[model samples]
Target chain A: MPDEAPNDPKPSAEDSPAKGPGNPAREQEPAAQAASEPEARAAEVIERERRGPSGEPVRSVTFAERKRMNRRELLKLVPLIAVGAVAIPAFRQPILNQGLRFSDWTAGALFGRHRLAQTYSDREVAPFEKFPYNFYDVADPGVDLEKWTLTVSGLVQRPGDYKMDQIQAFPKVVQNTRHVCVEGWDVIGNFGGTRASDFLRWIGADPSARFLEVTCVDGYYESIDMATVLHPQTLFCYEMYGKPLDRGHGAPLRLQMPTKLGYKQAKYLDSIKVTNVLLSDMRGYWEDQGYSWYGGL
Target chain B: MAATVAVVKQKPEETTTVVYEHPLVVRIAHWLNAVALLVMIGSGLRIFLAFPSFGPRIPQQNFFVLPPRPLTIGGWLGGALQWHFTFMWIFVGSGLLYVVYQIVTGHWRQVLFLPRDVKGLWPMARHYFLFSPKPVVDAAYNPLQKLAYTSTIFFGVVSTLTGIVMYKPAQFWWLAWPMGGYHFARSWHFFAMLGFVAFIPGHLLMVAIHGWNNFYSMITGWKREPEYLE
Candidate 1:
């Protein structure tokens, strides 16, 4: 280890040479030892040189002679790094851009459903058909539309919130999909709702929104990168199973973000906001508190 | 002058090597390091099984006991979380104390981060693989070993930070900002697991190459003759 930095300022990392015992004498010991290393190495090198006819020639390679790495290696890293650099910046644009990620991720989630998944065996319009998802007993979807307004705020141009009915009018598109939870559960359901992207686009959100933070009426919330939101597997749906969607599920409106874990799917839509910067690690009400926010398998 | 003249005619003293390395606490800490690494890896696999798919879709096999989410290990997920965090503190606490102990006791000098070591990596690597001429007899650790140990410490702290971010994100979420976010923290946590997995095998190989005589010294607190150590 001492051989690593031959010129480090620390003194010789070994036994101290004997000196007359005194306060000042010991005070100068480190300085005295510090002065001895190069001299000692030189003495050792000189002694070795005197003994052996050939020692490893000082340094066979000089720094100037070194060449840059080969083109192939550099080429391989370019695309990967470039993608990350580009995508990461997308998350830091501005507040108006905030909900864009949610739009994109939800849009991607919607795109994943091949016509709203396979319909349930009981296509008889069971309102609470999507009931008992996983084990969490929270999130009673008995949502009231009068109080249901998505608060679109944070780092945005026009941060005024929109009501669920207002969002529903923005070019509704329903697709069937299999809701796959990371807990190894998959449910086939049909969800009809306004395209979150269409709604975001209608709102004319900032193009640079890189992160999407969503808060649900029931206090459920999640966040995701813009690219992930737009990955064609995300969805924004108001109808589930077959019928006019009961409030038991995330009725009125809920997101089915497929690429990520189910936790990102905030039920009972409360708000959408554009953000240029991603949430600080300290953000995320649930995830920040260390429940799996990614919610994906 | 008289003392120098008197010593000039003196006979060479017989050298009998003595070992002075770890005290009992430090020794306990070291063995804990070895043990904890193995347990972390074992439990880490159980956690990874939940994902089932990862970078490159690499197929994985479960080894030993398979459990789930380190936090809630047994009631639903049981003992794994307790074991993981419990030993995690032991591993980390001991490592921290050992470092402070080393600093206060001045063992840091013996292992000062060296420029020679930074420069010696390739040569030390080459020497380790026998690609170069015999390795220089390092007094403590070779440059490469120093680098590896330093990186291990760095990763150890990172592992702890990421673990905290994963565990109590509300309290330690600040740690995740430098990395990326929650997902990024999770990625870092997983990668740290992989790093430990990779490092352990390589570590054992080095130990084997260096011989068990030195390896056992970690337990016995006494090594075989350390050549040229005087």
Candidate 2:
């Protein structure tokens, strides 16, 4: 194929390194330096006609060079083989974690923060009988219901423990959305709770706080991005299927964020610590092991 | 007269031709896609191991057995997802760019299979399987090649669309609904990767049979040819 650049004057100039004044190969051609466009065109045509169909210069490869190439090709496989030898076991998590912050930044840029998770009608919600035991790390420790309080701390003016009634007093928003697990199972359910954005606003949370550090009763801790924390679908959920969350479910409280994978929706009522800086050492129980921290969709 | 004689003497004796089999963009996209597919398959296998069975956990073995645990990328589900979501963009970007390049350069004519190619497919298949007689090949690709390439492109499109469905099923319910809901989309995504796994060995074998020169063309965008009789 003819070079596309030859027709486009700008690209022909940009592409040819020899066009530069400092090019050593052209330094001897003082007369050629002053050569006009027609001369250059003629030279280009001559060079083009001399080349083969693919624009590659026809050349002779000696037997010795071809012999050496076999070894060279074998040598090329060395790094890939080395990576295969020790990629996952030795540095799986570390290598996966590398450039994760950048990945998150790119995802944020591409997907944007304001986009909402898809919602379904109440009828589309899957029946509980079909697929049970969907979530992992289920913990329902005995607790005094009256004495239980949902604590809100860190980067908030109203940073104090509030009773279940106090939490319930806030206006409720009901959503029928699919809960997608990282393990590749999903179910639609009717989740009722205060919108997370509203809750963040109600708590007088600092707008500048970048993350929400959530701790569960089972010692399961996870940090969610502020964008997700303030997502319209993200909820401090307490009701499932139009009833108060049962013991098997996260009673009194659980995060019902459809945008995230199942693991990110931490069950069990616990303290929420909002902060500007992310946890440097630990991100989450699963995230520390190598999971993408964002877990969006 | 002396300079002309010297130039003639300096020229090599062997008359050879080099065909530009691939453009620079195609070459770059080809390798980018290879790396992207490798990373995706590795991490996707890890993701699959998180829940090996479809319905519920059953100990009984089926026809398809997964590679050993260590061979798999499933040490950590989170880590696997990390690798999967990250490299997914690279796969999407490179694949789309390749399609765009083909369309823009009118290279799709050489790749996309037409009804007329069906007549040629049987002969190509017979040549490969029966070892009857080698059929005349095209300068770029054969009919069988066009069919395979076109199907693989379809596979890639489905894989990416299924990925989106899995990623945000709730957000992209319209996409998931046509695929028979979330679970179906997941299965489709898994199977598409399997299609890639199946396609790769056959692709490599063909390249091997075509010789190292064929493989080298992808890297350097040039193919070696003997001098033709005018």
Candidate 3:
């Protein structure tokens, strides 16, 4: 509202000199009258003398010269048309998924990896009802704390399953950040976790690996890019809002990715598989259906 | 006086004259806008379809319908978002340049709506509806065109603001508050997109009605005209 245009008199087309015969005032203007007489005389002379090759002057003006989309212009459009034809299908999900990768690279480069996600204070937390809870499964199949373990495999030097205590034994980080959903809502939560970078390093994850494929206990699988996996804010969350995570909140372990959508933060994380393999479609659960794979800010 | 006088037939020679309607910068900006807006709308629809409603319940009276599976840009939400945010720069950058150029060059005076233009709205509408001859105004744009072009700018601002708020509610929380909240801002963003999409068809139809010279003017920045004296 503050940016509303200031009230100013605009010059409409009708305000132009001599819109039509209906404007008697414009016709009576001495300046307009003075200007029109010579123009009218010139028009009369041109009308009489001007002729096509056959000798009759054109009555209604035809923009034959200007209207034509000449061959040069038509040729110029061919490359554009071809690019559009290719880009149309290329941008879609399954086939020719080349464009998304380019878009990803461009956005990733523009908003560099170091650029931090916005943090928030307790007072700014989104209202409770606005907070969304999304998961792959119909019910939260509560994990047994005594038996559950996080398995690290693939290109990691330390390829083994570790109990919660063993995982929590590492350094912990606490962050208060906004969790944005792909469905267009947001919620703020305090997450306590170990820095994923530290954990990956602790486990000796292959630095050269292109992807870190994570599978949740709920059968949800997602492939994350190395740059995002090592993002400073990316966490292997164990606690939410101070207390340990509840059953519905991915109790044992969850990936808290502030840079990504809620869906990208795979819950009840069961395993982390670091690999150099780049799948044709590196999509998460929702992404495979039609959600964007790179749901970053 | 007799020698100077010349008789004219049914159609006058006024149309033979040529007018420089669209300037070079304006033409470039116009085409860039067309491409950017189309991509935004298509990918935006993909984003919208994911949630598809303002609230938990779907709207009872659904009018605008996309295909069961339209050939949308940006494959998925992540892909669509990349496309959306990437082209967002193009949209915003060009839009800012266009607006700044218009204001700096005094072209805003010709396009911006004013109280005076209201008086001509009905007449212009009548001219279109009743098939009456177009009034030959010596300005760059007619009253109706001025209104449409001006409103599009307003909608563009709305879309941009709402989009930013939705993108980062905590960062732009102040902007989100006036829109009622984050979800409301998203809804408003969707509505703004709808407003823009609705405007496109009407705008294209008008261009078609105005003939090839009108369309060519946007591309070549030149319009063949008639220097008619009423």
Candidate 4:
């Protein structure tokens, strides 16, 4: 087999470093070298050949030697077999979980502390009717609207139940922002609420708490990272399109973070806890099942 | 392109020659990427099935027929996401390794399709499709083969870029600007998958038609009596 350099202008066997002076083959192939050529010139020719246009060695090896070389090359690829471990039932979940966790960690790291989610103008907001009511269990979890008070606990200085008016006491913020679902659908809707940071400060919640865990009127629960909890756009939403929350939309108070997936925005807020630790088995409703915990963006 | 040819003599009149083809790095990256692509495509289809449309949630309009269950991987949406997320790193890693290696080694000239290759494409296509006279074999890859391989890099770039936007739309929102927005990026990501779907069958068919020695070369980095060499 000739070592052909298709586009290469000069092809010569002398370029091969494998043909060293000590090699018997070099002595046997001495016919190519001119007797009149000085040793220094001949050495330069060999050096230039060794560094050929592509710096690729041009050589010939016996059939048996080729087989050995092929075997060695094939061996180099054996590490790729480790990727097949995902096929095993026991290993699959753990490996995938690690991958998801890594992705979540990256997402969390990429999340800007003060950066706000993209806000849209009023005209760009999706029609109220167009916003689909997505829920895991029921769209309208029956909550006594008048009696409903967000039960605050954990690391907050104020650990008592608070009425909707108390949450509404903070200066109101209204903005249109896109809400993305884990299923890949998205809608820009008008949301009215107080900044979660302001509300956290009012509630005397510890500013440095690592996570804010929340439960819903329904069985669904979620834990949010403190960085997101303090984001200006993270809202304890009480109104949508300037109307008080409807039963279908988590009524009294629900998390309305523009930066988080719809699932992380727990609706029909029941209790809130500021804590550093999350129950291993109970991260979030969908997250425990498989969804990424850092449902950022 | 650091290829070596070796000849072995079995008898006085019998001699066989073998040529190194794929480098070890290329072989490793190729197989790793092959596995990653299979997982990515399979799991991606399952993820797409959750919504199956680019339209709004209300008055939803599905784009096409749902992919058959057998064709998809992972049992459910969440499970499919796990597979997709897991293999994404591998896909990107292998692609980067292959590309960086090609560039650093200056081996890209062997397979990268350039403007100069445009003229040879018709002749090669005619040879393959119309059963015309075989074009003279010279390089490891012909113009059409170069085009096919080169297009994959384009598809890979599109897929990875769109994937990043979809994965971190808020953080990488600027990336979506060129493609229009997050919604359009999703569509582009799906289309990129379609590009691979279109390429796979033809790629496999060509490999099958080329026989075992050709396929073995990818694994062993050597081809026995490659026709181009003859």
Q: Which candidate number has the best TM-score? A: 4
Where does model 1 sit among the CAPRI classes? incorrect
Better of 2 and 3 by lDDT: 2
Per-residue lDDT of model 4, residues A1-297, tens digit only: 343322222455343333222444543342244345433222212222332123333233334455666788878888888888998999988899999998899889889988878888888899998887876254577899989999999998889999888888999999899999989899999999989999889889898889999998888899999999999899999999999988888888899998899899999899999999999777999999889899998
Q: Which stretches of candidate 1 lie over 4 Å from their true place?
A: A1-297, B1-16, B53-79
Best candidate according to DockQ: 4
Off-target runs (Cα >4 Å) in candidate 4 are: A1-58, A136-139, B1-15
Which of 3 and 4 is ahead in TM-score?
4
What is the per-residue lDDT of model 3 for residues A23-71, given as tens digits with 9 covering 90 to 100? 3353234234336564333231212122222121212222243233223
Q: Per-candidate DockQ versus the true complex?
A: 0.05, 0.25, 0.17, 0.41
Model 2 clash pairs? A54-B20, A118-B170, A118-B171, A290-B79, A291-B78, A291-B79
Residue-wise lDDT of candidate 3 within B84-190, one digit each (tens)? 76567667766887898899977787789888888788878888889787675545467898989898898889999998777655335567778896668877887
Model 1: TM-score for chain B: 0.76
The CAPRI classification for model 2 reads as acceptable
- Candidate 3's docking class is incorrect
- The residue pairs that clash in candidate 3, if any, are A290-B76, A291-B76, A291-B77, A292-B76, A292-B77, A292-B78, A292-B79, A293-B78, B14-B226, B15-B226
Off by over 4 Å in 3: A1-96, A112-116, A123-132, A136-142, A154-157, A205-211, A281-283, A288-290, B1-15, B20-32, B35-39, B52-137, B164-184, B201-205, B208-222, B227-230
User: Against the true structure, candidate 3 has what lDDT?
Assistant: 0.65
Ranking by DockQ: 4, 2, 3, 1
Q: State the lDDT of candidate 2 residue by residue for A94-143, as single tens digits.
A: 55566465566655555546777778876777775543453434456655
